[model samples]
Target: MLISLSRVIKGYLLSALLGVVIGSLIGMSRTINELLLPMITVIRQIPMIAWIPLIILWCGIGEESKVVIIVLAAFFPILVNAESGIAQTPESFLEVARLYKLGWWKTFSKVYLPHAIPQILVGLKLGLGVSWMAVVASELIAATSGIGYRMSNARSLMRPDIVIVCMLVIGIVGILMDKAIGIIFELFTPWVEKKRRD
Candidate 1:
């Protein structure tokens, strides 16, 4: 699951960015907030577990359904964090970027993105961890294959050792995924390291 998901980092980042932009637009305009916030609030309140049955029904017990649930579980944290990071970007940086006549794209990539990388990475790490967990919970409920299914089967068959092994595997994989994201963030945003020193 982690390996497959790693391939979707660009997709995850794009989706998260879109979420932030849209959410902030709504947040900034109180009119939109009154219209849209309740819908988002309702969706946010729906537990990932509670969505399993409906997701399975709507999407079927296939890879598609599982992936959808994972996205739902992972999306909100990254969305909220990205929005906050973007909206809270220091006004000084925006002023500097504007003074230099940086185009919107360059300003975003060179200034905003670099500045927001740490917070965005934090959200990604959290989202990935939760997605990993959601995948397992999902597989246990309906999947015939996957580590979660394996663990569930082991538990049902009274194989405690196998269950323990599965738990250890899940923990190790989750930790490694988070560490990998951290390394990537550090590599791409060396400025973050310099900022910490001051």
Candidate 2:
């Protein structure tokens, strides 16, 4: 569990950072959107499972391979949602920024980023869920440690009870992580919470 959690956390953080930065660029710059959107769409269409063998070949079925797979599994939803959220920022808001003579960085901080936070959080939640699944799946296929490996080992020993226990633990842990993220985001974006309450 610790091994898997570490990989998931590393992959999740990297993916989130890349997703937000790249998504913001794609959303804000028409040239970037035109250049990258088609390629991203094509890559996104190819399922992650199909890439596993190639990834293992490239990364040698080690921690690197597992982390790479988790990153792939989590990156797209985050990128899409962040792009959508930033691009959906109101034109009127931009006008306000311009009226105040705000520069690009200031406008982004004051208008675009704030508008996109909620959607970005939604993407992060989705990414984290998929990341958990990805780590487990990759570990099952190729790993010496982790909850998945423990389950696989138990299967060979005919310990069905351990497998069942692992499954239950996975589900519980995933739910807890999801709820924790939601709570943290609600704290960071209090307006979002107020809107939900209303």
Using Cα atoms with residue i matched to residue i, what is each candidate's TM-score against the true structure? 0.83, 0.95
What root-mean-square deviation over C-alphas does model 1 reach?
3.3
Query: Among these predicted structures, which one has the highest TM-score?
Result: 2
Per-residue error (Å), model 2, residue 90: 1.1
Q: 1-198, model 2: which lDDT tens digit per residue?
A: 778889999999999898888899899899999999999999999998887888999999789999999999999999999999999999999999999999989988889998999999989999999898888888888889998899889999999999999989888888998899988888888987888689
| Backbone clashes (count) for model 2 | 0
- Report clash pairs, candidate 1: none
Q: Report the Cα lDDT for residue 61, model 1.
A: 76
Identify the runs in model 1 with alpha carbons over 4 angstroms from their true place. 1-38
* Model 2: per-residue Cα lDDT at residue 119: 93
